[model samples]
Target: MSFQAYIDNIKAKTGKTPADFKKLAEKKGFIVKGELNPKTKATEVTNWLKEEFELGHGHAMAIYATFKGKTS
Candidate 1:
């Protein structure tokens, strides 16, 4: 599937946009001031998404990608 497809499916499942995730990540300290914290690992973020949001690995990674400034 395409990247946008992954993003769309994530939204359909979670009802949240990248901007929303960004805000939550900021609150959770995955990000700081719109920047992804260098000390944070992808697995840490992905695991949090998996546990808290019930997101599968791909979807969780997509959100983590967004934290790294990707569009999808």
Candidate 2:
């Protein structure tokens, strides 16, 4: 699937936008000031996404990409 398609599907499934994920990631300390936290591992975020959000690897990675400033 395309990147935006993945994003759209995630939103459809989770009822959250990228901005909402960013807020949650910030609360989780996975990101700070709109960037991925240096002390946080990608797996940490991906794992949380998997467990808490029931997202697949690719879908979780898509959310992580947004943390890294992906928009397209």
Candidate 3:
């Protein structure tokens, strides 16, 4: 699947855009001022996404990728 396809599926399943996830990530301290905190690990964010949002690994990683500045 294309990167956009993953993004679209995530939005359809969660009813949230990457922007929305970014905001939530900021609150969780995984992000700071639109940037991902260097101290944060991918697994931490992925696990949080999985537990809180019920996202599969790939979907969670997609969101984490957005946090890392993936826009395609």
Candidate 4:
């Protein structure tokens, strides 16, 4: 799937947009000051999403990539 398609599917499944995930990640300390903390590991964030959001690995990675300002 395309990046946008993956993003749209995630939102449809979770009812949370990319912006919403950023806010949630901030509250969870994955992000700080509107940016992903440099020390944060992808596994940590992906594990959280897998546990809390029940997202698959790929989907969780998509969100993580989004945090890194990726669009592809």
Using all chains and alpha carbons, the TM-scores for the candidates as numbered come to 0.94, 0.95, 0.96, 0.94
Q: Report the C-alpha lDDT of model 4 over 17-63, residue by residue, as the tens digit.
A: 88899999999899999999999999999999899889999899999
lDDT of each: 0.89, 0.93, 0.94, 0.92
Q: Give one digit per residue, the lDDT tens place, for model 2 in 6-41.
A: 999999999999899999999998988778998998
Instruction: Output the better candidate (1/3) by lDDT.
Output: 3
Superpose all Cα atoms of candidate 3 onto the true structure and report the RMSD in Å to 1 decimal: 0.6
lDDT by residue (tens digit), candidate 1, 1-72: 877888898899889988898899889898987899998999999999899889999989988998998984
**Model 2: ten consecutive residues of lowest lDDT:** 29-38
Error of 1 at 63 (Å): 0.8
lDDT score for residue 6 of model 1: 81
Point out where model 2 deviates above 4 Å. none
Candidate 2 similarity to native, TM-score: 0.95
For candidate 4, the lDDT comes to 0.92
The collision pairs in model 4 are none
